[model samples]
Target: MTARAMTQHTEKLADKWGAHFPAAELEVLAAAGYGARMGFGERPALLVVDVTYSFCGTSPMPVLDAVRANRRSCGAWAWEAVGSMRRLIDAARTAQLPVVYSTMLDPGDAAYEPGLWGAKNARGKEDSPAPAAGPRRDNDVVDDIRPAPGDLVVAKGKPSIFHGTNLLDHLIARGVDSLIICGGTSSGCVYASAVDGFSHNLKVTVVRDACFDRVETPHWASLLDIDMKYGDVIGIDEAVAHLGGLTCRVS
Candidate 1:
């Protein structure tokens, strides 16, 4: 679909579900000091969450096939957001800021372990049934914006990157006080990471256009909720501009 048509389609979904908050509500919240800006910090890092083929469908995999069967998949939208994310990544790299990535890698034998959230969410399935035979590297990051040398790549099993990873310690060690997050699905991993970042006292900025969700309403709702309570939901250009405004640093 054309970009204009896709936007109109998303708007229709948002309107139908009341996903867009009323302007009056926002005004009242602002008056109540609820949506106050925290602004960017001296040291900021880019946290790209779950830009993997399993979610984006950049490659064929059993998980992708199942997700596609659900009809609620947003693979196309996720693919669309990739360019914007690349721009943010490039800007962050140029500013000499740390770039971190989170991927939900295959858990191998742990796939059979009970209480796996992804498995539990699979309509109560014990595990995602792999294809009878095919390539299975669905957890790999999309090639266009894969992590480069010197970039931190964390393999996480849960939706929130910080839940079972050393992401927090790494950020603290790097002196990062702010986080710029982008990836898919917005209402899932992105939302979880943003909330965790807020809870950690880190200033969080979510690049809205650089994030995608399996469904449009939840995407809009999640962004609104994050903007109001957890972090600022901004556009890609605004994020890149902020990075560009940073002083050049010796790498």
Candidate 2:
């Protein structure tokens, strides 16, 4: 495929790396063979990485406003990405593809150690007052795109879904050689998944519109990095088309 053919991020007219990387620097990377497409795989599966209320907050609002509900909240873009994810999920389901979701174990759970997370981040865990938004389901996946019946769910500790989780086993069991990934915190979980998925030799494809982050910078940066070295960061429509092309095969 052409270099620009695989360059369709949700940023519209802007190039994913154009704003951040200087033209001369980007040219150097291109000369060094950095931004070529890794292409898609044969057998594909959808991996929804961390679309929980922690990242999405209680509802659609500004990032700062939603962060009141939960400091991890990424705000409005998270919900928008959720909408895209829902459509992608519907397309995948219609194509009879396996759908897998990854979420964090509950904060109260014995296995849910926040580690440096609780110490560093300002999520009201310290002597700070509780959020004005009241009780929130920090770990549960968002209702806008909850897992359907027969979908696989994995609770993970690390950023990468494949780390210390049975995600690899599930993918191997279903003969999933390609991953169409979506969901929140693109610079965090989604980027980590793309890297690990690539490390596992799986064809990783991250849906640009179907992923979000705390802000635009890291979000686009991670997608650019994933596209450069790890996976194909593509548009939601392309992802839907890819899944739809899988035929009437059973999940």
Candidate 3:
């Protein structure tokens, strides 16, 4: 098959680091092929996921250099995602759509630490042992985007918002049938949330410009996968426009 005609998963891998993947995901791609054309009804809520320090950049992952490069260097466009997401949040508030913020919560709640990091965690525990002020703080959101009054924040231990969280009930009670998800590490939490949103039958929309990941491969791969299988992947401008129309009707 031609390159564009390549199966979904192959195209996903190829789109990134020229990696190769099986065509098995093509079946899933076919099922979600028309996601862009999917109709989103009234009542949308903004769900921001895992935009925390430990997952974002405070930890030393292989992608940290890429994040730093995107942050303090020439390719800073990636870092602009934070500001873009902020604008989206503002638009959500203006539209009167329910806004939900999701972040990691581990105030002495580190239930899972990799064996490789055991010594580091132990040393840190021995020294101060307490959760640091910024990320571990009970009230802190990310430095980039802060939730204002009336905004709902959901503390989560796992990647999926539905896992060990009251997000589904909150959305259901608020009459929110659609979700606009934005945040860091697009491949992990963002992807997981979108998948769960799909499973729960919510109209899911992911903002391409407003979501960031430390690495490029997984970010792009996850975005394409989500777009092809789970939700509509659009720019923040489109997302805001969609929310704007809804807001005008309700307001």
Best by lDDT: 2
Q: What lDDT tens digits, residue by residue, belong to model 2 across residues 1-251?
A: 35674243222324656676666666655655676677888888999999988888777899978876567889889988898999899988888788999997765666766666666675547322333344545777888789999999999888889988888988899898999999978999999888999999998899999999988888887887888788888898888887777775554
Residue pairs of candidate 1 with colliding backbone atoms:
none
TM-score of model number 1: 0.80
* Residue range 112-206, candidate 3, lDDT tens digits: 33233335343434222366655344324656777788888887766787888888999899998988898866887889999999999998888
Give per-residue CA lDDT, model 1, range 150-229, as digits (tens). Answer: 99998886779998789999999999999999998889999999999999999999999899887678888888788768
Off by over 4 Å in 2: 1-20, 124-136, 248-251
In model 2, what are the clashing residue pairs, if there are any? none
In model 2, state the lDDT of residue 29.
59
Per-model lDDT: 0.77, 0.81, 0.68
Sort every candidate by lDDT, greatest first.
2, 1, 3
- RMSD per candidate (Å) reads 7.8, 4.4, 6.4
- State the lDDT at 21 in candidate 1: 66
RMSD of 3: 6.4
Q: List TM-score per model, in order.
A: 0.80, 0.87, 0.72
